[model samples]
Target: MTAEHGPGASDIDESRIPSWIACEDLLVKMREELIDRAIKLLNREIESGHIAVNGSTLFSSEANADVEEAMYLINNLIDDSGRLHKEYSEYIEKNNGKKLSDAEAKKFGELQKFVLSVEQLNMLMEYARVLSSWADAAGKMIEGKDTEDILRKTIDKEELRKTVLEFFINDSECRVLLSSKEIEAIKSVLGA
Candidate 1:
């Protein structure tokens, strides 16, 4: 059996195989399974209307474009995460039952960390969805009430807008992890 690295060890070389290839394979498989579960959770949320784009006057064509761009980023991130998980799994399976060096063990640890980050990004996407829904609802509220009154009554329109922008930024970061090409595509959409 290969020795397990402590959670605090951050110097694991992901490029090298660890002493226990079997353990690495198991970790890769677990990452893949977690990715699958996250995807399922996202889909279920969308289906259940927990994550939805409400129809509101606030959902202007321009805002919709931004929202769509964010969605694109989120989807691409999911795809990249899934692909990486598959590739890592394949690599492990090809060398099943073999002993890996410390360097290799480090690489596996890094892969696991990447998987965790992807999961965190997915959670952020869910947050963005909720924010989008709120904006839509708020826009509807504004449409019926005085704009000035609504703006004043609502404690933080600016903060809400900033949150939306931050969501887009987080989405962009996820895409950048996938590919420079994807990052460029997102930039083009944002006119940035």
Candidate 2:
């Protein structure tokens, strides 16, 4: 305890809560942007049809780079990832099975969420598939004397996807813990 700091010290200067990392949220945005840019490259030359999921076909627009549904699922995943990370931080607060300070606990809860259920991995995979379809279509349209320049855009898009996918794959609670088959599906779509 310090005097200038509240009761005793003349040395303590600054203290503040650390910011939480929202990698998942940013990654979702990156994914959406990649699709959007790809669509622009090809002038929105895409198709629409029913999307097949888990051995069943769901009627939804198959293309045009509209990734609203994908975004919804990704946002849920971001929340879930935040909650999971907070859970670990909270767990670490317990020393030898003894509960820590109420302030710490409260902060953890505030930083986290009660709804812990994550977005379905299959749905995320489907989103990746849709993105890949758009990418493939857009890739074919790269032309003109600026072909090399446009191809760079494609490279950047894929790189962003890779970065996002790696984020999920590196987190055990997010996507790394997924089944091998499901992981393969994501990789195929991401061209990883």
Clashes of 1: 12
Q: Which regions of candidate 2 fall more than 4 Å away from where they truly are?
A: 1-77, 92-153, 162-192
Specify the poorest-scoring 10-residue window by lDDT in model 1: 1-10
Model 1, position 37, has a per-residue lDDT of 43
lDDT of 1: 0.44
**Mind giving the per-residue lDDT tens digits that candidate 2 earns over 56-103?**
234366682245544443444455656665665565455334564888
How high is each candidate's TM-score? 0.31, 0.24
lDDT of 1 by residue, 118-141 (tens): 566666555454444443444444
Find the candidate with the highest TM-score and give its number.
Answer: 1
What is the lDDT of every predicted structure here? 0.44, 0.39
Alpha-carbon runs more than 4 Å astray in model 1 = 1-75, 86-99, 142-192
